[model samples]
Target: MSGFNNRNHAVLLPERLARFGPVEPGAKVKVRIPTEHRSLPFDQAIWPEEAAVLRTVSRHLPNVPKVLATRRGFSVQTFAEGTELAAIWGSKPNVKGGVVEGLASLFAALARIPVDELPKPPAGWPAFGDSTGFIHCLIDYTRTRVEAPAHARYGPLFGALGFPADALRRFSDGLPRDGLTPRPFVLLHADLHPRNLIYNEEDGSLHAIDWELAMVGDPVHDLAIHLCRTEYPNRGERQRFISAWHRAVRAANLPAVADYRRDLPWYVGYQRVRSVYTDVIRSVELLGPAPTGEELDARAAAVCRVLARAWAPVGLPGSPSLGGVRAALRDWAAERSEPGPPLADLRARLRRRLAEARTAFSGYFAGAPAPLPPDGPPASASRMRAR
Candidate 1:
């Protein structure tokens, strides 16, 4: 048994999770989520929000574990009991037509979520404006705050990547109003990274967990971010996911507000920058306790490289400049190649973990239903006041 505390309701795993290969399937385990604001003032609210969303999803989704147990700030559902995809990404062979098919199915499911029915960020949380505004925040955080130290350490590299300060702000300022239009708002799992996904070995069912940042917003926000992170430097894989998403949208019968294909490139860029800021913050926090100057320099270089790569256009949908992105990535990778200490290895390990997760996720689309149509006629692309 494990002890409970201010935030978590601790549950011990039936077997040691790490021993079962770091992540395992079918062994029962207890997990805890916060019931109070122990980590952040707003943390307590997230527990209830998660429970509510889980309930809604269970009710609507066929394969999800129905609610099994509950407590004040925590609930235990029958673990979907599957292999975490993050563990096996790099080694997986390319399955013909699988990646795109799976992603499209995932997008269609996301599109089906009724925007108004999902949870909201607390009263004063930072509002995500339109996608363009969304892009601006990414640039500001990365260029001004997140990547500041990195820029200082690797000034020449930053310039080489063409990532000047205020790059996002400048582009945002020059964009037309139409550029910022929000797709029809919908429920979004803001942090839809790989660890949050589990694939049941039994039936190849995909179960998504971790709803800490889940909220109502443009459905494309989640889709774009997922694709950007998963397919970033891989042109073939990226195109596959985009195609899958479109098919899923069409099949799910969800509203189609506009041509998602045309808007995808812009949104992909938006997500890349957003992810750069997020990753930098996480890296700094993880490398705690002022290490050697060499370590800090390497950390900074990594952040700069990611920003530069994020800014490189992945090519517009349907008009992929075949070898363009590949050459760019190769060049970026070659220029930044330098040996550093354990911190560089740590970053590499983390990235590998993400890649593994992407691999594990590849197996879950086996039974994806053909795309559904919009639930009804598409809603007009109108802006909503940031609440």
Candidate 2:
């Protein structure tokens, strides 16, 4: 597919494969497979092995896709039948009228769902009304899952850019795990953003897809993620969304937001910090072992933007300029190569396989051919699609 917005590899199976799709009405259908790009340990997932969380949550949320099935390890769900929300609200997002009201109502409905009715939560989930403990869970997951795993390869790069080895630890230490206002834990879409939302102008309704990162946590945590992920046209529009969110939460009788004003910034801060590390590492992976001038520049520009925003949030000693970030990424990549080799010889071998390695990860279905080809060879995903 030309557009792949999710962390998972998703495909719209052709009509012949309709027997493998869910038994819903004759609508568009797609299947999802977890991406092999082992980049980060998810802070948003509580049960890593549970593939049915979306299906379970869908059972309760009617607007959510209900007839989910699995085939050859791919989770099949009906395509959201509407215009992509991001397309409706272009780069300059509006905050007034039905857009604001509809988004607010969606959040309110999500909050109102009784936690018991949803899927069984993971062990060691925060006790009832434990906002502080809830945040700690996320911070710890970032440290243990995201940071620790990436340390061997990316630790030095982080240090080079002024991120302390103990950044996550410090953030965790400063956080109070119990005394903060007790916000009741509730279902969080965990990855909600305009791209994940589908808007139907006919009925003025919004539907959300991709609940792979969904979790049960403090409600404000949900708001913090939405605020960070969705691009607002301006500050006033952002505040409007927040105001609408509070109004809707109160109307839903879910008092999981009492101290959101005080707590929102840090949760927002945490997300920014997480993005810096994740973005840089992702750049390195995308560069592969042999990045061309254009590839390096493109990745550098993106990383530099995220790195610049992260200085204050992660307590970096100094702000990162674009030039410095490009240099750091360059040095980091060079340092990763082995001590002895004809660099040209090694790269020649790697370059031949790099194209297949990248696309196949995102497109390979069990026993299915590879994904879209790069024109060098007929990739298995592309071949399967053609057949």
Q: For this target, which candidate reaches the highest lDDT against the unseen true structure?
A: 2
Model 2 superposed RMSD (Cα): 6.7
What TM-score does each of the candidates earn?
Answer: 0.58, 0.78
* lDDT agreement of model 2 with the native: 0.64
Per-residue alpha-carbon lDDT of model 1 for 159-258, expressed as tens digits? 5444554545544554456765555555666555454566665555577766555665556667766765452346776676666676677667444435
Q: Model 2: which residue pairs collide?
A: 369-380, 369-381, 370-380, 370-381, 371-381, 371-382
Off by over 4 Å in 2: 1-25, 48-51, 91-97, 176-179, 288-298, 338-387
Give the alpha carbon lDDT tens digit for every residue of 10-96 in model 2: 344544445554543445555444433234654456655334666566666666754345544445556666777777674424323
- The whole-model lDDT of each prediction reads 0.47, 0.64
Task: Report the Cα lDDT for residue 59, model 1.
Answer: 57
Looking at candidate 1, what is the lDDT of residue 344?
Answer: 44
Q: In candidate 2, how many Å is residue 173 off?
A: 3.2
